[model samples]
Target: MRVLMVSWEYPPVIVGGLGRHVHHLAIDLAGMGHEVTVITRRPSGTDSLTHPTTDERSDGVRVIAVAEDPHEFRFGTDMMSWTLAMGHSFVRAGLRVLAGDQETAWVPDVVHAHDWLVAHPAITLAEFFDVPLVATIHATEAGRHSGWVSGSTNRQVHSVEWWLANEADALITCSESMRDEVNRLFGPEEIQVIHNGIDVDTWPFAPRPQTAGPAELLFAGRLEYEKGVQDLLAALPRVRRTHPGTTLTIAGTGTQLDWLMETARKHKVTRSVRFVGALDHNALVAAMQRCAAIVLPSRYEPFGIVALEAAATGIPLVVSTAGGLGEAVDDGMSGFTFQPADVAGIATAIRKTLDDPAAAAVRARRARDRLTEDFSWREVAERTEGVYLAAKRRVRHAYGRPTIIERPLPERDPGK
Candidate 1:
């Protein structure tokens, strides 16, 4: 199957997990002998053109980077303008591919759009080509803001998300929890749950020394309010009371860094909490190897890929019972789960793992086993391919011998 993937984030311009997810999915799909073409926003400061630039990877994936507006984004309107500009570029790129401008160009059988950022373009291209649009909602605006679209920006984003779900032929989410949320919020006719996977071999598995100095707890993700980093800081004092030598290491940066430091000072656990801004893959693997356990205390996690990474590294894991984090780990069997924003519960779970090395090791082993057996990129790609096939079948039945209409590409407003 030939697939066209639309996303706002990609390598060298990644904001979060969504970019990494798309990168892996596209490459893996191409490796599976499926023709995959990815259309994403080009990184700023590069050669910015009004047209899209194409790059072919050794793994057989073709990436088309759509140049975005060069204007500074100061307000919500500017951001929307940029998104619309990207959509316009995507439409133009699709038209070129359909017209066979290049020797290797071929029309995509399925248009797979990731998240809401590229929803506008994905919907437009799918409709223009009269093909199936498969949308993957990585996270929802309402979920990120704790079940509320507080501001105009959030409301608009939520509305776009609703429209994308309504427009797509098939909806795909990263977890069962997300599938349920999409059903409740958007009421999509059908939704498929595909677990986000990780490359288990990428992380080295080495047991910490039996006689390590202090039990190091690691939190590796954005230090944001919804990520519950502050809650983890609050739980540190309690964790220290049980195991005084225990220390916490945070690996990531976000708007809440200063506030998190301030929270640590207020809790009088500043000395024990080390804010390590961000670590690359190798450094992160070292950090994980050094740490006794990994904690992800998210208030709302669509799918906790970090938990899976920790599990793959054979590290004891503790995550909040929020959204997909709970589904990622089996409470007590593979890892521990605490209530969202529950400081005591978070501390207790951490302390339990620290207090019992044997039990913690057992849980870690179980998690590693599960990661190898279930959560792999190959498995994820296979499952995703199934969705694409189903969507193709639906499109074939609904629009038998559909005709493509060559319409003029919509004009983009850079100053909207």
Candidate 2:
């Protein structure tokens, strides 16, 4: 299969799990003998003149990156316009690839879109090439806000997500919980659940040594309200009451950094809390090796891929049973799980993980064992391949793919 993947974030510009998810999946798919191509943006600060737009990775994936337009538009303040510009860049790069030498012209059998961010280009490429568009709704705007689309930007993003979900030939999500959320919020339809994967070998099992001073608890991923890091902060004082030397190291960065710092000061746990901001993946893995346990207190996680990475490294996990996290860590069986945003519950789970060394080690072992069967990239790619085939079958039944459709946008109520 000649698979063309569309994602806003990719290697060297990873903001979250979506970039890593696409990175691993594409490489694995190519390893399995599929011709994989990824269209993404050049790293944040550089342009095409500074960085090579076409990267032929040794892992058998061809990456064609685009430079943001030389405009005075900031993504934060001008998202709609920024997204349009990015989409235009992606389409241009894709068309260049498709319109190469007649003898070496490249064509993709399917266009797989990562999230709503790349929906415009994915839909355009799929339609222009007459191929199936398989979209993965990583998360939804409504889901992030706990079923509320309040701001104008929120509503705009939600509408685009709906358009992508409805327009795609087949839909996929990172978890069963997310599949339900997508169907409920968008429209009733079948959406495949493919949990985000990790490279188990890259994350070798590194059991923490017993010679510890303060009990170190690490929280990875972006620092945001929906991430429930604040809840973790709320539970810290309670955790320290029993384990006085317990320290919480907050990794990653987001809009809530200042607020989270203030919250720690408010809780009087500032001395014990360390804000290390964002670190590269290698550094994060090394810190994972040193920490007592990886804590992910996500209030609305579609699927906690970081937890899987922690599990793969044989690190004990204390996560919340929000969305796919419940499936990722099987409570007592694989690390520990508490309800989302449960302050008291968060304290208890951490205590439980620290209270028993033998039990936690056993659970960590169980998690590591589950990696091959559950979270391996090989398994994820195979499952994704199945989805591609299913999407193609759906398109075939719909009277085949059309090379071109010069139809105008249908009139509809935006509020609906």
Candidate 3:
């Protein structure tokens, strides 16, 4: 099957798990003999002049990184407008790439769009090609804001998301929790739940030495408010009481970094809480090995890929039973679990791991053992392939043949 993937983020420009999800999915799909073409943006600090809309193959996948349009746009300041410009740029790039060299277009059997960011291009390209559009709603704006579409920005994003959900022929969610959320909100005819997967070999089990000076706890993922990083910091003061030398190291960057740092200061755990900023894959895996345990205290995680990464690394996990995290890391059996935003609960769970390092190691081992059956990339790829087939079938049966209408074009030539 030839598949066209649309996404806003990829490696080197990764904002969160969506980038990693698309990268791995495309690679594994290609490995399975599927022709995978990813349409994404060039990394920041580069443009069409320098970057020049690259079309290269990486790890068995054809990646076409489109340079942004030369416009007066700043992502942080002009988020919604930036997103609109990005989607239009993506549409143009997608058409350019699909209209292959020498008038031989490399048309895909299906167009798979990831998240709301690339919705416009996804819908447009799918319609232009008269193919099925499969959208994976990574997370909703309402979900991120905890069911409140407050403010103009939130409402605008939510509206686009709703439009995308309705337009797509088939919809997929990264978790069962997310499937439910989409069903409740959009009332989509059907939504498939495919949990995010990770490569176990990449994250080998190398336990941190039990004998430590200060117990090191790690919090990864975006530092956004919904991620519960602030809540994790709030729990640090109490965690220090149990293990006086316990230190917290935060990995990953977000809008909440300054606020979280201030949160630690206010809690008087500034000395203990250390923000290491964002670390690359090698550095992140290394950090995982060096830490005593990994704490992912997300308040509204759709599906915690980091939890799977932690499990793959054989690190003891203390995750809140928020959204799909509950499925990723089982309470007590695999790792300890707590309710979201419960500072006392978070501290108690951390202290439990610190109290008995041996017991925590046992749980960590169990978590690692669960990865093969639950979170393997091979399984994820196979499941996703099934979805692609189903989406095609839906297009064929439900919609029959897409009506092809060729509109006459009037040439705008001054010479003529």
Candidate 4:
């Protein structure tokens, strides 16, 4: 089957989990004898589609990057702008390919859009091309840091997300918690839960080299105000006083970087805090392996992909009982939990893992076992393919028949 994958970010231009998810999904889909064509917004200096740069053409998959108009709003950063831009680009790219005899001319049987970033294009392609559309809502605006949408800008973002969820043929999310939230937001059974997964082999399996010390705690991801990084910083002061040599390693760069740095300095624990801004995949895995435990102090989280990553890497985690993250981190088993904004609770959870190495090790192994059994990219992709098949059937039933083709063909090209 031919599939069109739409996303705002991909490798070399990723901001978070969405890009990584799309990249892995496309690769897996292509490997499964499905022709996958990915359309994403181009980073600056990336030669745009008039000269369309092909990032890769592995197996039967192709990637097309289109330059998008970067009109920035106060709150709209990488995701919002790129999503809007990707929408426009997807329509444009679809038209360009449909009009020609390009390598991607076979046309796609299904349009799979990742997150709200590609929702615009996902909707447009579904209507304009009359194909099955499947959207994955990684998280909701309400679930991100529990912030209120007051202004026009905030409303616009929320509006886009709502539109995508409603317009798509089927909805996918990363956890049962998110599925429940989406169901409540859009009515029951509106969203399907497909937990996030990681490449187990890529992550560091063993802990980082350590000395007799207090312990090291990790918090990785975007440095946004809603991410509750400040809470982690506040917790650090307390944890440090109790465990003398405790150190906090924050990996990842975001809008709240300066404030977090200032918070560390103000708490007089600057020496114990290391702001290792933005690690690549390998670096992050290594850091996770070394830390005593990983903490996600988000105000609200949809699925907590990082928690899964930590679990897969045999790293115990401490996640806030925020939104969907609670579903991912099995409190007292895979990891521990605390109230969303409780600084002392966050500190105490980290201390638990540090003080009880034997128990922590047990949880870490269980976490790894759980990931291996349920959350591998291969499993995720296979489940996602089932979603695609269901979506195709729904579209077929709605339309009464396939319009452009008789059946889903094996591939556009018949012979080698």
**Candidate 3 structure quality by residue, lDDT tens digits, 1-416:** 99999999987578888999999999999999999999999875567798778888899998888998887777888888888888898888887777757666898899999988888889888888888899999998888866767566777787788878878888999888899998877768689888889888888889758685888899888878788888888898898887988988999898877878887888898888888888888999988888889998998999999999988887899999988899888888888999998999999999998888899999999988887788888888999999899885244333223222232323311211
Task: Give RMSD to native, each candidate.
Answer: 7.3, 6.1, 9.3, 9.9
Q: What's model 4's TM-score?
A: 0.87
Assess candidate 2 and give its TM-score to the true structure. 0.92
lDDT (0 to 1) per candidate: 0.82, 0.85, 0.85, 0.74
> What residue runs in model 2 are displaced by over 4 Å at the alpha carbon?
393-416
Residue 414 error for model 2, in Å? 31
lDDT of 1 at 24: 87
The number of clashing residue pairs in each candidate reads 0, 0, 0, 2
Query: Clashing residue pairs, candidate 4?
Result: 208-290, 252-278
User: What residue pairs are clashing in model 1?
Assistant: none
Worst 10 residues of 3 by lDDT: 407-416
Clashing pairs in 2: none
Off by over 4 Å in 1: 45-52, 74-77, 97-105, 392-416
Candidate 4, residues 280-337, lDDT tens digits: the string is 7788888888888888998778776777778777777788987667776688988789
